[model samples]
Target: MQFFKQIKSILAVSLVLLFMAAPAIAGQPKYVFYFIGDGLGAAQRQFSEFFLQDQLKNPNSQLVMDTFEVAGINTTYCADTLITDSAAAATALASGVKTNKGVIGKDVNGNNVKTLVEEARDHGMKTGLITTTRLTHATPAAFASHNISRNNENEIADDFLNSGVDFFAGGGIRHFIPASMKIENADALGKTIKSKRKDEKDLVKGFEGKGYSTFIGMKGAKAFKSTDFSKQDKVFAAFTYTHMPYEVERMNQYKNVPSIADMTRAGIDVLAQGDKGFFLMIEGGRIDHAAHANDPSGVIWDTIAFDDAIKTAYEFFQNHKDQTLIVVVGDHETGGMGLGMDSMGYKLNMAALNDVHVSVEDTLNDGAGQYKGDKAAYLSYLSKNFGLSNLSDAEAASLNKAMVSADAGETLGYYKLNPAALTAAHILSTRANINWTTTIHTATMIPMSATGAYAGRFGGYKDNTQIAKAMAQTLGFTL
Candidate 1:
């Protein structure tokens, strides 16, 4: 009887150990959603959270990304520079290798490096790349194409034809068409598609020949949903001629263009149809653009829009918790943005930003030219559009100085911002107590957060290259 009792105890211990090890034995995740917020840093994200809380009048409001279990800080320096550009930063995040600035999916010696997308495809998984910028841009191109320079959009566009990626979305239609071809009547935005390619080869037709069902502009995005892709799973979609409009601009005018969240949902629905699983990369590309312009409202709104896209992935994760992994990270920090300014004396009035209804880009494009020379008219325009009504004598003088320069068609600052637009944007940002150190990329650390299968692998402080390394390990492959 004693011997039998000991045998039963041993059996119970064995069963407990087996159950605990079950998840490890389950192999790689079936679905992976990789989200990259271009130029998103700690302050950029915090400002968005603060903006939302103020907008909702709830102090306890939090971003969905802040609620993730696995969170860490990621260094963003490149191999050759302290401050990394989008191309080199993206290559490190996608290939687990750091290259010099301006290089994409290639080493310092110009040798091609295999990216995570290539590994996913090798493992019999479907891949998709979606971004608010052109698909041929640095972030997306780093994953699927190899080139010596990120500026070679024509070469990057050609790479998509044979990348074996099942789905493609966002802008860059110009690079695909021939220089002499005019494609306006067929474009959904009713804008002419002029080619940037030096060759006469029409790449859109090339994509079509490779068994891809291509869609163009807002109309194309809507048609992408209704069409049946069960027979042909490959798809290519371009929603604009260049980068997608900033969130503020889109909300006020381009209502037909799809949001980043819209594209994320669409990419998931189409890519998830396969049985072997899928890898989808979604980039909020214009946060970098807005930050480079020192437009606080533009950055806040676009980051909010990016988080909405993450919510879409989080919802999908909820249903497939055991088989899905969602990772959210920023390629690098832009603008050196901060929450407090010296004049604010430790106070940040996020609520003040609510008075401003438009972005700096729109203000310059639509209104600045109309009220340039007249002091009263320009001040009135500032009050109506940028929410600056009662300016002190010095503030008014500063704005007047900018107006004179703008009227003479001058572009000022390091990023060559319109003088009037830059002045108005700075004043608006000051009202909210936000400060920017520079209108360029900063070597600051960005945030990385994840959830679901093997999400714990990404926790703790790490370099940007480790991101791809961790993903490869989670997927049971080598980067």
Candidate 2:
């Protein structure tokens, strides 16, 4: 009897010890915020930080991402190449598997791989996707769609509607509307028109049929802000027919469009109501677009906009510190961006970027053609928008040449910059001490940061696939 009592006592002490050690094990997070900055890398992040310091005149100013407790360097190579496009990089980050270029949520052999978002749905957790790009764009599409080709956006849109995500906000409504249903917008002064879908399926109506609260365009999104998100089981908000306007252009031209931060907040508000927790992915997609154009001003503003979304997610983390996990990462780097040039040596005047008022895209579309025949008007516009002053004789000659070439109906490659816009960008970049090696994607390692519950899982050097795996593990799912 004494021996049996001793055995029971040992068992009781062991149980007590186990209970005491329980707090050391990290519990599964109730909420996860995955922030993907497409085409953002170390240089891009540093450039944004420098810009903020220069703009705010606060050397101590820091981005919200800088506050994360754990940091990692992520290798962004896809299965097929050292350099990865948004589709393949997003696939690796979402599905814990490397995929070929232009693929979405599939391996090299064309096998469908379930994404972290899908895992969340299977676990009964609410899922949300928010992006500055279209909802069917590469980064967000990888989370919800399984397609052999990323270019099949119409099919991707169909996948998104049936993916069971609770909230989605972005652009690309054209994929949902049939071409026959497209109409000229009188409100846009006939300058803008609706996109036509080939399949003629009304996806907005389809979403409504499935009990989703749908919001389209600026007006619809504004109306959504006034609705009770808690009462809505699912919500979809798309602000543009394609990708949202670049941040610089949006601020100057499209005031009605919602910011990425705004969309993220709305996503959290709606998804947080789920009983089984939630997973949300917010993408600052225009950073990639601007980088692809090799436009420093556009890239800086978009990075700041992305940082604003990070701040929003951080605020939510402050309240649910123990139950939330927030991770910020970039799919890949574009534009081989660097801060210093041979002419500038080591000195960088980031404040010179403030002179840029519009994106290269905006300059090409709006200003270049308007000034094609008028030299004086063109120079004055450059002075006002690009802050170029006291142009040398050679510079003036080059500008005139560009304008003359543009007037002669010269066209460059699809990805090449407009001659007039390129001149302006070169002047601004020279002043800002920013240089770009290529306009295409680079085989660079991107930075990742994490905070809140189980953030340590993301620390150290990791492959992009490991990010998805860590997220899965944190959510108690097997990748």
Candidate 3:
């Protein structure tokens, strides 16, 4: 009886151990959503949070990404330079390999590196790519195509057509159409269309032939809304000719174009139809564009749009908690953006953002041109749009000088901040305490946050390549 009792005790211990190890033995996540906020660093996110708090009049408001359980800092250096471009940074995040600047999915010696999206597709998972920039742009292209040069977007478009990715939504339909094709109709925004392709292939038609449900503009996207996604195995949507318009600009001007959240939801709906689950990459690409242009308003609104998309993914993760993994990160820091300026002495007035009615791009294109060489017109424009009042004599002179210089075709080299744009930037910065060090990418560590299955693996400081490695491990992909 004593021996039998001892045997029972041993059996109970064995059962407990097995039960404890069950999670480790279980398969990895079936769904993965990877979001890349291009040029979004810690400073950018903090600024956006502050802007949101002030804009919404809620001090307790937080970004969707800030609510994630696992958070870490990621170093964003390419093999060639400390400061990385979208191409090299994205390739590192996609392929778990370091490549030089301007290269995509290949090493310095030009060896091909398989991306996580390809791995997911190889493992029978559906794949999707959504971006506010062109689908063939560096970030999205790195995930789905390989090219020695990021500029080879024409070839990249062809690669995307053959990539087996289940869904795509963004801009750059020009790359799909042959240069020989005459485009008579305007795009969704009433902009004249022209093909950027060099070959004779109508890739859009080819995509249709391959069973992809293609949508060109706002009209097509609206039509797509009524489609039964369960019957549509593949879907592709493009809203603009090049990159999608900035969120602030889009809100104020192009109401017809789909939002980042809209594309994300559509991609999720289509990709979720697969039984084997899916890998979807959503890029807030224009944040980088705005930062490069040193447009604070544009950057802030686009980041908010990106947060909305994150909320959409978070909502989906709520239901498929056990089967999903969502990771949000940035490729690199752009514009060296900061919340406080020297003039403000650490007092950041985020409320000033609320006074601005339009973007710097809009101010340059629409307002500045109308007020060329006219100081009163420029000052009045500033007062109406950016809430600037009582401009000093020096400030007025500077504005007139800038307008005159811009009118005369004077250019600011490298950083590309023309005199007129610089004046607008200065006003916004002085009002909001926002500061920018440079109009280019910086060698800064970006924030990375994750939740759901295997999220704990991503916590703590990591290299950009490590992110790709961790996701590949979570997906059981041998990168």
Candidate 4:
């Protein structure tokens, strides 16, 4: 009788504690800012680590949120063969359900579903979307809209009018403008047999009409335009409707085009100020683009820049401590990028990662001018930038042959040319080293990490839907 009384007392106390905790757990403050580095894989992460290491005072220094946790999730085929595309991956991450390769925000049967972002809004949180790609790009649209095909971005962009989120950014101004305002959708037109959205609705005006504060270009943003961002709660920026210029082009052309860091900083600044807190999705969309072209230098540079953005968010959390939860991850891998091959016996010189670069566009247009062949001008430029004064005549001749697309293998172009690839190919055949099967995404698991509040749920092996479902539950919302 005495022992039975003890067991009963313990059970009664445990049940009371459980009942007492339910409301407190349900009412806990919630925040989630997810960053997707498209096509970023282990190689991209390592490359960024080393790229920043070389530039940092202490080589061991990692980006701010680097220590969260490391987990790998399998990236498999959608409706296609072995690999996946950004459209498919985005749909998987956003909707917690996988779709076919070219589809967005829907399933194989074309059923629309609840995205985490929509769930957050339904639960009354401010929402924001930011990316280095065009605003209407596949990744961003996954959370905002659904379509039978990814090519229907214009229609998807229209869907943002009703998304009711607080923030949006990136490029592709042309996509949001109708034919009356644009040579509209030339890029989309060139991709299709019949392009009907060539002249469509203006997504910018659509957002504005929906009560979003919208603008084009970083400078044109009324919020970014003034140093005082008190107006940001009432304003959101959309600088370009299409993809932002590549980092190289941005550095060379616009001089003031904000780095990924700047954009992230501004987005967080505005989003966090609200009483309801917010959910923001920022992307390094071009790291994938550069990787697809197999341009190691371009990809490396973008990876470093992406780190800059991560650092911005990392610092914010550090300041706010437990108030914010930041998760950084990648959607898929691309270009089969291998930093250093075992066959080559040369680890990429941690120092020289970005030393060699030329774009495929640059190599294709080599010796040939935009008008006619300005052979002298092109030769002078190469000599000034990349002349090898100490090569043996025979080897130099072979190299020159390769440079002009006359080599025994793949065409030598900007994406194709880089010192590391050259060295690797010299030791191993081009078929072995830097062997890009296609300019498409590959089936390599992506890494995800997180810090602050319920972060214990992250890391280790998991599936795509698991991430969304876990995050949704953590933030006190359901997907």
- The lDDT leader among the candidates is 1
Q: Work out the TM-score per prediction.
A: 0.90, 0.91, 0.91, 0.80
Tens digits of per-residue lDDT for model 4, 1-479: 99999999999999999987663345444557788989888777776676677768577977654667644454545655457778888887887787888888898888887787898787777788888887778889898888888887778767877777777777666666666653332231121112235775766677667666666654453335354544566444655434665565455444455667777777777777777777888888998877766655556667777777877877877776666778777888987777666544654555433333343222323212111234344334433332322345654555454444432345433454433234323422232233444455778877778877666666678777677767777776656
lDDT per residue, candidate 3, 182-251, as tens digits? 5455566656567898788888998999999999865775676566766778988876677888888678
Candidate 3: pairs in clash: none
lDDT of 3 at 434: 80
Model 4: how far is 377 from its true place, Å?
Answer: 3.9
Model 1 vs. true fold: TM: 0.90
Error of 2 at 28 (Å): 1.1
- Model 2 lDDT tens row, 11-101: 9999999987653235779999999999999989998998898888898998999778899999999988999999999999999999999
lDDT of 1 at 417: 81
Give the local distance difference test score of model 1. 0.86
- Model 4's lDDT to the true fold? 0.65
RMSD of each: 5.7, 4.1, 5.1, 6.7
TM-score of 3: 0.91
Candidate 1 stretches with Cα past 4 Å from truth are: 1-25, 183-190, 222-232, 362-378
